[model samples]
Target chain A: MAEIAIILLNMASYVLVLVLVALGLVVVFGMMRVINMAHGELFMLGAYTVVWLQAAGAPFWLAVAAAPVVVGAVGLVIEAALIRHIYRRPLDTILATWGLSIALKQAVVLIWGPASHSVAAPMAAAIGVGDVTYPVYRLLLMAVAVAIIAAVFWIFLRTDFGLVARAVIARPDTAAALGIDTRRIYRASFVIGTALAGLAGALVAPLISVDPQMGLGYLIPAFISIMVGGAGPLAGVLVGGGLVGGTNNLATVWLSPVVAQIVVFLLAIVIIRLRPQGLLGGRDGA
Target chain B: MAPRWLAGVVFMALAAFPLLAADYWTGQLTRYLIFGLFAMSLSLVWGRAGILCFGQAMFFGIGGYVMAACTMGLVGGALTSSYLGLAAAVLAAAGFAALLGYFLFLGRGLSGAYLAIVTLAIAYILEQTLKSAYTLGADNGLSGVPPIDLGLFGASVELWQETPRYYLVLAIVAAVYAALDRLLASPFGVVLTAMHGDPRRLAFFGYHVLSLRLIVFVIGAAVAGLAGALFVAVDEFASPTLIGFGLSTEVLIWVALGGKEMLLAAFLGAIAVRLMESTFAELLGDFWILALGLVFMVSVVLLPRGLIATPLGRLTSGRHRDGT
Candidate 1:
């Protein structure tokens, strides 16, 4: 019973982390139709922002708190300077953002000197859930992911800004005709989406060795989660995240990490072939 | 769209290149030529067919591994012939593409970002698989692939010298380029262009859009596979990077910066970027990537047609005589 409980908790935390990582990509891609290939780099920037702040004598939580703000500001600058020009051309945006990813990666390498840095988890305690004691940080991570997702749904379903954002996503021309500032909505949505990615990155920093390429490792899985979940409804985030992240966690336990990744990707391809709109379809909202 | 003489001139310059350059440069140019061939394959599918295949190197890498396996006698000893290896490489890569494309192009199929993301995922999968498959040398990859044995019957004439190998690669590239050009000029090409511009319109005219796309994708994969096979002759090693995300994106940059719309530009673009890398890598160190990335973004945004393509088109094509 303890073994099963432990496995279940691991799977839940892993899936929630997948959800957190994929949420930004889903919102931006679903709402703006922009690929944002540099998204992984945005996540990397978030973790590095924490690294940078802590080195300057900031507390761990304070650095984590500042990650989203710094990353959001950076996203604003990128959206204004680069992304603003190519919203209509998805293909060009893919190439452009991939270019941005390369630039961001190199910039990180230059700043951090290509070495991997490990951020200490603020919590030194563990909570016993049976025979196996789970790290406090891991439990906290699950709670944070759930809370953030709930907040996103609230923003989408209840807030006035969300109503306008959804209007733009549903029909940009109509939204503009209705006197909504669609441009502001796009910019804001992009910023929020990137901020989420940063937050996810900062959260994961304690668990993984923080490196420039670490973002890529998480990036593909996040993409797989989003793909499995479907790109539309908010519910797909959890569904897709569970399927993908659950597969990875369970497979890693049974086989190897590499096999786990291979299986998840192959599963996603089959899913995409069978249902391109995803399992839940593009219904949008909660 | 460019003048036939410009093509002739380019081919002439290629033939004269080995003579003018040093042996080291000659060897370097050979791989660049293979990359150019690879880029042209991308141009055929991406620029013309409107398929942005982000994982093209997977096909190329498959070809490289196939050639390595065949030549290394991993596949029965009698099958170690270079000719057989090249054929196997092309067939293997094309087969994989056809299999992948069938699923990808099924129904309305995945286009734009979805297709790109899926293909990238495949590359990621393949790279990880290769890294773990110990029989294929795991992360170390297979090495010591012999040079192409240009033998007919029992007689063996190994292409070990730089000059001969260079000529052989160039000749093959020229033949492939000519064939692709003719294919593009055919009636099939017209349908392809129509489909690229508007698949629904072409479908309205009763063209089997799915089959046409599959054919183009298969053709592109086959060409990339052939280039990968040729790459073994130059590098004598087959690593997973040949089929991974880095090489895949690098090739995209080559085609994009070279001008995806024009095949000649893509061919030159790979060679140009590689040459720039060799020259600037020492001076710029890791920062060269940042510069390249910046230039690539600027080019994609400001000059959608391509950096090299725009100027080359103006010089060679009468259509752009007015500089529009």
Candidate 2:
């Protein structure tokens, strides 16, 4: 019973990470219909920023706080320079973003020299949970992810930006007629999405190895999460992330890590076949 | 007439490339040809049929493994080299395509984006499966398999080396390209073009949307398998990377860069990217990925129809407009 409880706790934290990663994908792919393949790389950038800042002797909390802003600015520049033109064509964006991912990966390799960064666990957050001995920082990480998800949901539901963004998604020309700056919304949303990915990376950097190709590792599952949840739906991302995360964690416990990963993918396929739009995905976007 | 001669000359040059180029370049070209074939298969489904299959590598890897397994004949040695191995690889790929397509083509007609997501999942799942032991070789992949002997000749052509394998790949590429061109020029190709323009209208005109998708999907898979077989034959190695999403997307980029509508475009794009990669490796070292990204962004926005397609359209239409 104790082992089961510990497993469940670990699974919950993993789901939290999935939710953080999936949130940006939902906003970018769901509303924009633009599958930003570089989204994972942006996450890597965030993690790298934290790592670099920490290396420079900055406090861990300050590094975590500053990472997203730095990453988001980079994302804004990418959108301004390249992503802006491809808005009219979604497939083009996918390909372009994919290229961006490759480029970003290479850039990371150049900057960091291809080795995984040793991001020390925050000393303030370490804790004991009987036999398991959980890290307090991890718990804090979960809280942050939850807070961000809530904040995103609130913004989407209650904010003017969300309403205008939805209007653009529904019909960009119509939104233009209604005096909404569709282009600005697109830029802002993309930046935010990238930032969310970065934030996930910053929080999870301690747990996972921060390497150049680390983005590619996350890219597949994050995509699976997006598809299983329904591309753009927040609730769908939640359910999808939970399903993939929970199952993956449990499966790893029972089977080898390789088998566990395979099973997770298999489960995702089954879910997609059953509900193509994802569990919470509506019929709005393709 | 001059253009036709130029094309012929180019083909001949490519045919005799092993003799002309260094051993390393010959081997590189051989790799490019396999990837080119992979890209061409994607073009059939994505460009011509408008079915954006992000997991084409799934078939490529599947065919490779089937070829490897059969060649080794660990479980079923009798099936190897009995003309059945090649058939089995192609059939297995086609079968897998049909099964996956059945599920994907459910509810509403799948858009390119949705298809990409679904296919991405498929590719990921397959890669993971191959990474696990007992079933696939897991990470390291199955190796030490002997060359495939096609019966009439008792001696197996060792494709592990460079020169002979280059000739073999070029021949297969030519055959594949010719078959693809013929298929595209047929009535079936016309229907696919129509389907791409308007699927609802095509369905109303009595065309079975699902069936057409399945046909193209299966055909594409079969071709991918052929590429896989050739890949294993040449490299004498297989890795889960064959079925990776990155590889599939890379193939898609090649199709986009070359010319989706033109079969030759796939080969051209593959060659261009490979050459650029080698250049980047030599010069830029670590910054090549950045250059590739910039290239992809520029190519998509400026040449939406691809380099060959846009230029060919311009040249052909330019002459006609001037004449009129």
Candidate 3:
């Protein structure tokens, strides 16, 4: 019973991290139609920021708060420069982002070597729950991921900016003709997308070792989630993340992690074939 | 006048390459040949068929592993020699490609994004599968592959060192290039080009657009497999790198750098990028990816048509060309 509870807790943590990762992709790829292959690397950068801050003798709480801001700022710069130029062509966006991913990964390696960096979780949050001792940092990560998703949901559902953003996605040319500043919305959305990815990375850093290649493992599943959950819908993102994360975790527990990955990807392929639009997606959503 | 002589000259240059170059140069050139064949196969889908495949490595790797198994598998009465191994590898690659391509291409439905994602998934799955199936050597991969042997004439050509492998690679590359060039210049090639432009338009003209794409996609995978077979013969090993996403994307960069439309150009691109990597990576080290990124950005911005296409455009326009 205890082992099962621990496994379930671990699975919940996996699903939580995946949801955060997929949420960012859903925002960027769903709205902008860019695949953002480098999104994983952005997550890596966020994790590294936490690693760097922790190394510099900063308080863990302070580092956690600051890491997202720093990473989000980098996301803003990426949007302002290269991504802005290639908004109309989504495939080109994918290629460009892929290039960015490679460059950023190499940059991370150059700065922090190829080895994985171990980060200790916050001293206060290192608590036990019942017989199953769950890392408080992981629970914190779950909280943060859930909070961000809720915030995004709130912003999209209630805010004027999200309305305009949805309007642009619905009919870009019409929105442009109506003088909605589509480019600004694109830039803003991209920054938000990148920031979300960074936040997920920072939260995940203490739980996993921070390495240059860390982001890549999460990339395929995040993509699968967005595609399976439907592109932009919040519910789809959660469902997609949960399905992939839960299945992958359970599969890994039963089989090997390698076999689990293969199975998940195979499932994604099948899902894609059956529902070209995605499982939870409405008509017109990618 | 220049086109015919250019083709002939290129062929002649390739023909004379084995004799002039030393053993080391021959092997390096052979690797180039194999990569060229692989790149050209990608061109069939990416260039002619307008499918931006981010996962050519899947088919390329699969073909490589199949060849590895054929040569490495010491089952009863099975062929262990490189020649038969290479042949078996090629057939196996093509067969798997036919199956994979049919399913993937069917689901693709002319959506480039969907195709890219699907291919990526296949590559991801296969990569993980390769890691798990340790009998094929997994992460360490299969090594100690013997050189190919000809028939029972007791006069077999083997790649003992760089020279034999180099020349062998050169011969295969030249032959593959010739075949590809001919195929691309055929009426079928023209239809493929048209399909790339507008699939729906071609479908209206009674073309089995999906079928045609599938055919080329399979052919491309087969050619990639052939390259993989040759790769093992030349290098004497097969690692997961041959089928990795990095390698796949690198091939795309090669095609884009050289000009995807032309068969020869893609090979040139491969040589250029690899040569750059060999020369500059020591000095640049980790920043090498930055250079690639810069090159891609510049190419995307300035030479979107590719080096070959840009030069051809200049030549056909009868305009004075700027230094590329």
Top DockQ prediction, candidate number: 2
DockQ of 1: 0.64
lDDT of 1 by residue, B109-219 (tens): 888777888899999889989988888888999999999999978889999899999999999999999888888889998888898899999999988999999999999
Best model per TM-score: 1
True-vs-predicted CA distance for residue B51, candidate 1, Å: 1.1
Complex DockQ per candidate: 0.64, 0.66, 0.54
Q: What is the DockQ (computed on Cα atoms) for candidate 3?
A: 0.54
Query: Evaluated on chain B only, what is the TM-score of candidate 1?
Result: 0.97
Q: Estimate each model's TM-score.
A: 0.97, 0.93, 0.94
Better of 1 and 2 by DockQ: 2
Candidate 3 lDDT by residue in tens digits, B218-320:
7888888888888876677888877877788889888887777666667677877777787789988878877787677667656765766577656655875
Cα lDDT of model 1 by residue, A16-59, tens digit: 87788788988888888888888899999989988999889999
Q: Which stretches of candidate 3 lie over 4 Å from their true place?
A: A124-129, B1-4, B14-22, B73-78, B107-110, B152-155, B316-324
Scored against the true structure, residue B148 in model 3 reaches a CA lDDT of 60
Superposed Cα deviation of residue A131, candidate 2 (Å): 6.4
True lDDT of residue A37, candidate 2: 84
Instruction: Please write out the lDDT profile of model 2 over residues A1-286, one tens digit for every residue.
Output: 6688678878988898888888987788877778888888998998999999998999988999998899999989998888888777887787788778888888888888888887988864656656566678778887888899999989887898888888887788998998888889988998889889989899999888999878877777887887788775568888888888888988988898777887788778777767777777678546
Better of 2 and 3 by DockQ: 2
Model 1 chain B lowest lDDT segment of ten: B315-324
Q: Write the per-residue lDDT of candidate 3 for residues A150-175, one digit (tens) a residue.
A: 99988877899989998988889999
